[model samples]
Target: MAGTSLAGWLLLAIYLPTIHGLRLAQMGTMSPNGGDDGVDFRPAYHITPPSNWMNDPNGLMERDGIFHVFFQFNPSAPIWGAPHWGHVASRDLAHWQRLPVALSPEETYDIDGVFSGSATVLPDGDPVIMYTGTSRRQELGFFWQVQALARPENGSDPLLQRWVKDPRNPVIEDAPPRGTNFQFRDPQTAWRQEVGEELGSLWLTTIGSQVSCVGAAPMYASRDFVKWEFFGYLHSQPGVVPSENETECTFGETQFGAEGRNWEVVCYFPKRVGEEVIHIFKYSDQIRGRTPFGRDWYVLSDVPLAFTNKTVPGQGNALTPSLRGAPFAPAIIDHGDIYASKFFNTSSGRLLWMGWSFETSTGCTGTCSDGTPLTDARGWQGLQTIPREVQVDLETGQLLMTPIGEVEALRSAQLFEQGGMKLVPGARRALPLKFPKGGSGGRQMDVSATFKLSDEASAEVSSTGFKVGVAVTHGRTGALTSVFLNGSLSAGGGGVEELEMWVDRSATGGATSANLQGGRVTLGGVAKEVTLRLLVDRSVVEAVGQGGRVRATSRVYPAGRGDWGLELFNEGAAGSVVAGVEAWEMEGAFVDDLW
Candidate 1:
């Protein structure tokens, strides 16, 4: 035992120094080991590269000019299990530096894994994190709940990177026992208290369900960042009849209406209503305490709200009067099979959102066992969408979201441009463009176009049938990339299918499908007419169709530097006329700038 203890001490002595050495290397300083090892890692802009299976991003906090983002990750295998908190830091939102895993399931309470959580500066001015603890026992079955406290290791010393868990964890685990029907989890913490109230009191929102029903977000208040008291049920649509499953990632602040005359809570949740996956919202006028209030407190019904909000106090709440009652429709932030998103405010004042982006099947299969075959076989499965900037419409109160602006900082130079192209029936043409000198000749490019389709041309194709092709080559033996839109029509079925395609230059000629390699989608159902936005980078592509539906992402790559061109095809054989097309040069940054 003594010898083993000595060996353990020896390991810590050696490992701590090595860890500190790596931290120093990241700071542009030489390591003590006499190596000039500086890391030059950057955040992926197009689509987050598949380092491994990444779920909801947690602990997104900014300090000392550095922004830290922690995510739910399964590093050992491509799929998710044995969850750990993966860490990455960025000086700008655009460029990211991957750090070591921040939190692992080292303790028995969290043996199953550390699930989703949030980060905040505690009232004592220390950095603290709150997360869910998942565990299993023969008697208890599978039980999980919210937990939190100050980081065990907190100081100004840059070399100390370990986070100590609070002794008194499972901080808010107040559900009614294991089989009692109520399941509670997901704690989002923020410091807000009245003048007379405790200074460090926190308001936490989480998903709770009573057997047979799902996803009723309950509220809890905490003081000292440890002990929590049940507040009340935040919001629920009792009679609306949830379709078997429902869950919420996070809830925004309580917005006060004009002159404090009204109040509303902003919550975002995923509801499996019937056969559709809908992102929905509900509003409230009264703040219920720990007890059940009258039916008037339930006056706010489940209504489809927009993504607009006015900037006020209460720390980035979605409640805003400025964007209330506008014609804006609820924009589907992600069109592909992505779900369970959480939004937070950055130090720069922009609203950023992150969610899990993977194919429906990959999530259902439990393990990301077949990485190579999955990439080759399933194509565009098991990846994440780039974080996006979210906004609320001033007139419609609906949400409007897009890729963050700082992402554009990554653009090296303009490769090509074409102003006027008219699409006619049964005829296809390619508009070739040249890459700017000194740009990444081997690197991929983002191709975008906005056009108006003629009514006569619209009548020929099915609402969901349209194809766009992009090719890149020096002259010969290059690559061909294609994006297809199908089943986009309304119930009646007759509208133009808007196209937005993200292509990868690296995988252009590969055997993998275009939709999976480095492609992404943002598609909408058929519309009378609409605008299209397409973003393609090295490993990801994002396409936003019309206002109705959005195909968020897919994967594809280009082979080599060559003449790049765009092609439009009518899959239904019904010719469509194109009005105009415009493409922009994109920019990449070291980190995302919130302002």
Candidate 2:
């Protein structure tokens, strides 16, 4: 599922000196229009490294007067290489200032790479980090993985600069007791455990595993926050068989952990709604036909044993409750390309979930194609999906996932709005007659729309289920690469309704190259209404239906200049639906060049 595009790759031999006050920095020559389009493929509001590559929103902590954002970065080149913990800080999550490299590989334990990790700020202060280390030492002789710790050199800096690796590195020095290959990494944030011991917080770090080659998440726990012990499992997917000879399935393996989605990278977050305590479990799944090969997977379950703060070993629900033991099956977190998520509480008194959006694909996504890198001058790789507030939906008995309100602070203008519009079956209209010729290419914008089936079309809606779509950017050749959100087709009676999403990227139709893949997200059956809030960037589009009761996102490349056209589409019968829609042109979040 890896996709590539020839995005006018220009060679750059230019090197700029670091800006004053910044410790580590670099920049490459960038084109005004990233591609041939007037719009650049880079996200206007999302976070990407100033140069080179970035993956996984790591060590996200908001404290004091600054918000710390650490990520897996390859400062050496745009393509993946020796990984380092690239650093940045923001007071408002929107504007980020480049900081020195937080953590790098220098010690024998991490000579190969300083991998992904988490940040935990104690009650007294400072942050303690637990990360994975991989090495091939002269004495150890063979390559292996181990857990490590780090702390700020100047814990008082507020910026949290210059990390110091623990001399007693590889704290969890041994591998899992179960023979689950080198699947150990990604330590979760710890919570205080023990009946009375204040320092005895319960901790669990997950490592990838395969029982007979099926994916599993084996969690390890620690009480003192230093010495660790192997706990039990959180969940497992039974029939994943990794390709024996193919080796290209390594991109974002932990940086984004895309390769292990089918059976790896189990992330957990617990929350309580009203009187019900809920535990959320997420992982990637690609069970052949059940899921689209390129996207990530998500699931939720109940916290077993009501979760007590007892400090006993292997007593936390994470160690005892099986994912299958939950009330229902795993549900998709975001219908879009989001996975390897982390959830944590911020100093602002809000719990948030952030995941790496597989926006730009290279090599292979879930499955491989002829290995070739994409050429679009996106200049960056990977981005953190908009931060979302995670809570349990007591009414729906599911998770309520909504983009944080802070995201709205990025909208700079109100471009277009329509009080209401009528749609006939199989009818289409160019949006924003304000431009006369469709649109002048509002490549980055926000769209909000609510659709209702016409009373006269209820019979047709129940039988065929009408479709309402927005061609974010389409072509002049009459080709269409639009995202369609359709709904409920009944059988006979007592039928369930659903609002389903499908991104149409067939190249023969236009807009984008055929290599760009799209998939569907069933927002369940809808009775009559579907409210949508969509964020459209130059090459990316993310949609949230009914405040994230369902979500979907995808990366698309425009195939023609005329493809910048934005329009409204209807499929069913003429005058079958009515909608009230509005759109706003978004402003870029990264403009200061703080580096």
Candidate 3:
């Protein structure tokens, strides 16, 4: 009778797929393409230029009412070699228009490729981009920072034309003492006006590794964006004493509260905590300042300052509006992998965020690869995560972030709905849903669920015990995020067991992974019940689980037909309960979109 019943249910499942507008025949079982192994996962929004290789969003700024986003791109293939600045612009920050390669490796100064940089509006109101120019000669690679001026020949067709690099290249060369690791690169420039000076000041931050350390970021001040002078080290790690390398990401204006009275210079650095990589902030009241000496200077214990914008005719200047002593304790922005984040001052009056998606490795290893190393083939490697919009909750004082809103307008085909359902163990449920009706577009989508586990189960596991599977067909192959208690479980031979909630991108062939561990908690509670939110775009999967306590993100590129479905797995034995499964389609929210 059980066998007959199971067969009947299988037949019903097939029929339900058709009724729900799903093409079951087209959807295949777990494979690289059918599962989470590729870069074309359905996304909440669609990227204008499909895919090859993209990384580190550079020069993210608004000019002439258009938001320009430049990225480290290699158009030759979907790998990470031969970097160039790929340009794209969007009016609404959702739908994007791909522009020509803004900056390439044509000049001897930038013969290798253009690395990462930032952009600011010049005093003349033209857009100025400062970037690191990397060159290679006789198997040796040297990086020199450069700046270029760009203007819209036609205000209406900013995306139609190309950005022109300055004729005088190598505006800033490697710091003197050619042997020192202090090759100035990754230029982050911003304009500020002094109290008594007629002309405003330009602040630039670059990464350098001296003889004592590997990579440390230093700051410089410039009267003009073109000519820059080294100010001092923004922040450095322990030198030789406990010897560790420190590399700083982008720096920006730190704002405090709605009044925006206090401002400070905020920059992020990756510090090694045990074996894991953690991101910490350094702030100061001195408007134009650098990192001090010793371990005390290593941590930002002092209060911070406030920054405000002062518009000067065509030029917009960000001045040190106000200052504060410093926080009694420095704050850590994220415990997981986040690097090179750009904070955008959007028209909507809210601060936005875009950062480089780093893997467990450091430096070039953080970049994605096609599994095979570059022996002699000129193929591309990794890409960066799409730009995300960040939100800070005033009540709890925690940061919440998601991709920008414009990406959410591209959803089609809605299939499953569970208003409220109590999930039970031993029994798995499959809901009928429809895949978006179109060619294999980018795989980007927003997935969220509110879960409640049994008290006994929670006590036993310390959390919940169940797996959330996506894009599963008849077989059990697909990506999954499993949540369970913290304690160890016995497998069979008395071995300890650990519950893992992660997104597997093996189907897409892009090896990206994310997960949550027990001991991790946000402000709310011990993550008793979690709202697992995932943004699946192309080859990238940004999964925020357990209220952001556990973030498992990876990129996958699969090679199969783009057909997907959702499933739930029960890791627990019989008599377990999995309750409250809710999934919602999400849209991007821009700073202006928030009231």
Candidate 4:
């Protein structure tokens, strides 16, 4: 997916001198509320490129108390083509500083593009980046992908602004026997363990691919970081037929791929919860109804497996027995516009996840109807989701994902706070609020609320369930996006109550409104209040429900723009209560002149 046309790369090279360093390096420092071009949809607090296209957080690691983020970028244009490794650094996670381009497609093996990969620290404490290099194979006259390695030009540089590709390029030159050549990319960070007495401290990594129409992450082992050998699979699963037909079916046709093929960006790691240690395997796929487009998927290996470093008697290594033969019952991680997520553990023991939030539509090329330049026309295309802290439930083995607490630093003085507000069925009421001077016109907000049924028995007895909603609206055009919570009895013969959070953007009128997505969790029939926390940044809206047990994120473009208004409504036959509501204006994260 990272490879672009040769013409695109050639065109980009002509402007490489300006795009690489001269322009970005000129920006001195980033302030919380400075350096924006008045593009309304550009996120204030999210991580975005200073200009041009950006996607997929790659080689994420913290070194020398500084966090380094390398991502897929196209400095030449605001579209996906001719990628280079764009660099950024941060001491506090909330604020960011731009750096020069880290890696480019200048070599023979990677002329097409420098794609996604992972970063790990060596035994000597120097960090190395393992990435996939895409190039056109002369013999076959087609593009091919191979695994490669790179290191910082000067390891002592805390920001890691410059990188040098290893002369031993294409460390793993060819895909394994059963793996498809082009489908293999995005190498996972290798883990080290002592294998047999003869093979000591082998490094193992997984490459995502499809074999026999089934998805797999084939593991490869290297004694050093250069020489490699084939190992078995970390996880494999066949795709299932989708149940919904909201869009044109493409997965089974030539346009997509074969029926049950799920392969992209393999991530596997272990975490200890209480007295037990469990493994998590994650991948990205474009299944029709499950993820419906591209989204992150995960499978929790619930069974107990020895995660110790000591060698196992029957299994050649401890990691092999723990990772191999793991079952593939996968679940969607986020129900909205997030995909290609990368995870890193901090020195403080916080496991963080970051993902690419791609544009939902083809995007406007020149100007919008109102004569303002669109996001693409302004020279930037994508932004990253806020970093999330992820943890597993000990009893249920479900994932709990929440926005990291560091983001709270961006919140301004509270703009609106209310409690004990009630609304009758089919009624809507506005919540009046004042905005900060020179604010983002309600484009940035941190809102938290709790909704509960005024009559719980009526909702349980009814078949359709009860719904309570909060609407963010443009007062002039009357366009709005609604976040609703619906509660109902379970349909699976259990008397459990099911609580669902759904976002409706049909009135927002943008490329992102096409998908009406929702996620639900079981609440044991006697559950009481449903809590929601929403983080909004212009086009992006992320909702965390039931204390991060369920989450959905989507993009919305309102027809007309001004300061936003908030309204509370009850859509079900029963009444509902807004126990508490709080909202705050958010400050910008980066101030750069490149925009």
TM-score of each: 0.62, 0.79, 0.64, 0.83
Q: How many steric clashes does model 3 contain?
A: 67
lDDT for model 4, on a 0 to 1 scale?
0.69
Best by lDDT: 4
Question: RMSD, each candidate, Å?
Answer: 12.5, 7.5, 15.0, 7.3
Estimate candidate 2's alpha-carbon lDDT, on a 0 to 1 scale. Answer: 0.59
- Per residue, candidate 2 scores C-alpha lDDT tens digits across 1-595 of 0001111110111122123102222332233322342234657677766555666667878778677778877654555655678777777776666766777776777777777778878777778888878775556453456778998888888788678888878887665443332455566665554323444446556654433233565566776567876655555543122333222122223323323332444566666656655666666544444334534455555545333332222223343333435445556677656656677777766678877765434333432212124422334456677778876665455666777787777776677788568777887877762332333367677788777665444454445565787766554666555666676545334332555766666642322335433334444444556667778776677777665777766666554554355677788542356777788766667634433
State how far residue 188 of model 1 sits from its true place (Å): 2.6
Write down the TM-score for model 1.
0.62
lDDT by residue (tens digit), candidate 4, 432-487: 86788888767799988887555544334543356777788854677788888887
Clashing pairs counted in every model = 64, 23, 67, 0
How well is each residue in 283-332 modelled by candidate 1, as lDDT tens digits? 22222231111001111212432212211122122322222233222234
Give the Cα lDDT of each candidate. Answer: 0.45, 0.59, 0.43, 0.69
Model 3 lDDT tens row, 1-595: 1212333432333223222113212342243223422223333243322234565677878766687878776655445656677776777776565566666666666766677777776556576777777665453333334433344444455553456676666666645121132234556545363423343445544443231222234455566566666544444322112232232222222111111111122344332324442333332221112111001111321222212221111112111111133222323333333444455556565456565553221112323333232200212233344555554333333345555555556444344556455555555566555444453332334555555444433334433334433333322344433333332333222222333344443332323333332233234323334355556554445656555434544444444443444555444542243444434343322222111
lDDT of 4 at 122: 79
Report how far residue 92 has shifted in candidate 2, in Å: 2.5
Which candidate would rank higher by TM-score, 1 or 2? 2
Please report, as a residue range, the 10-residue window in candidate 1 with the lowest summed lDDT: 290-299
